[model samples]
Target: MKNQEGHDNSMNTLNRTTVSLLTCVVLFASFAYAQGEYGANDFRIKVDARGQVASFHDAVHRRERLVPTQPAPLVAVKKGDKTEEPSRAEFEKEPPLIRLHYEDCGVSLDIAVQETESHVSFEIIRAEPSDKVDAVIWGTVSCDHQQDGG
Candidate 1:
């Protein structure tokens, strides 16, 4: 009887450890792929942690335009002949803005977004150390072939 009780306690400890490990895995997964969705009017955008546009949905057309897993990245800054992409991205929900930080080049780009009944627009409102920034390049977006009827 004592041996049986000891075995039960060991099993319980193992089960608790497994559960704790699983919980940590779930938390890490969520953090690693964290993304934000923002929309106004008929356009919706999903931006991932690496400052990539994971999804671009146009509600009126019933279409998704951007391929999230393509080799292309979003919002890069060109310094001289070298181009640096955002190492991280932060978003603001109130006015619909995304700030892309190019840590390597010490530059940041603030993109302001606006939507009307029939149109959506994006403008670069600010670029820190503008002298260091030669150009801000938005990444190439690949069309969804199915949506394109290709």
Candidate 2:
């Protein structure tokens, strides 16, 4: 009876230790994913005709031009019977600008590139449907242009 009680206590200790270890591992993994690295050389941006956006891993240079060459269509206004085109700055400041379709969520999101850094920082400035808020997603980039084929 004494030996059996000792063995049961030992098993309980082992089970507790295993559970603690698993809990620690799960917390660490969640933290890691939340602070994951996303950088210019590490990911690629996709923009569709309707302005929907997406991102993917950039395996190859795929060095296509960054933006379309043609100017975006301008809105014309008639003021006192005189027609005028919207100014360049007006077009530049448009928001909800790039729509993004989230395949997993079955919901579309709008995104904006807030900032780009050569070395350690990059930020996704905005996302929309407005529900997601203006949280910034930042990560490090391998700024070694030579090594990265930049």
Candidate 3:
């Protein structure tokens, strides 16, 4: 009788362990699905230029451009917390171009600028999945450097 009781208790413990593992798996799957949905959302780009040539390396990429001191409308998309605005020195080195590269959940973005007396243009490119290698984004910047007496 004692042996039988021990066996039954062991069996119940095993059953509970299996159920717990299954629950964990289900929760993990749901989390992954949510992340995928969020990633699929669109992102936007907004550039504020100082009306001069600027150069700055993004955390992940490198670029150069010329831009004006004023801000310009570049692109519209989803917003992310990781995005950062370029510094004055960075903008002066290039022509107001922003490049974003994502791989294995890692992201690298570069912003450059071009400046003119009358106008400035900015570009932004993004690669998605962010954690994977299947996403890619590209674009360009247009500025009126002629007006800046360049």
Instruction: Name the best candidate (by lDDT).
Output: 1
lDDT per residue (tens digit) for residues 85-110 in model 1: 78887766556777788888998888
Instruction: Flag regions of model 3 displaced more than 4 Å.
Output: 1-7, 34-150
TM-score of 2: 0.26
The digit string of per-residue lDDT tens for model 3 on 44-144 reads 12333321222221212222222435343232222343422222211222223444333324444443434444334344333343353332222234433
Candidate-wise lDDT, in order: 0.76, 0.35, 0.34
Ranking by TM-score: 1, 2, 3
* Full candidate order by lDDT, most accurate first: 1, 2, 3
What TM value does model 1 have? 0.65
How many backbone clashes does every candidate have?
A: 0, 0, 44
Point out where model 2 deviates above 4 Å.
1-7, 33-61, 64-150
Q: Whole-model lDDT for model 3 versus the true structure?
A: 0.34
Number of the top-ranking candidate, with TM-score as the measure? 1
- Tens-digit lDDT track of model 2 for 27-59: 654423211222364344443332322233344
Question: What's the TM-score of each model vs. the native?
Answer: 0.65, 0.26, 0.23
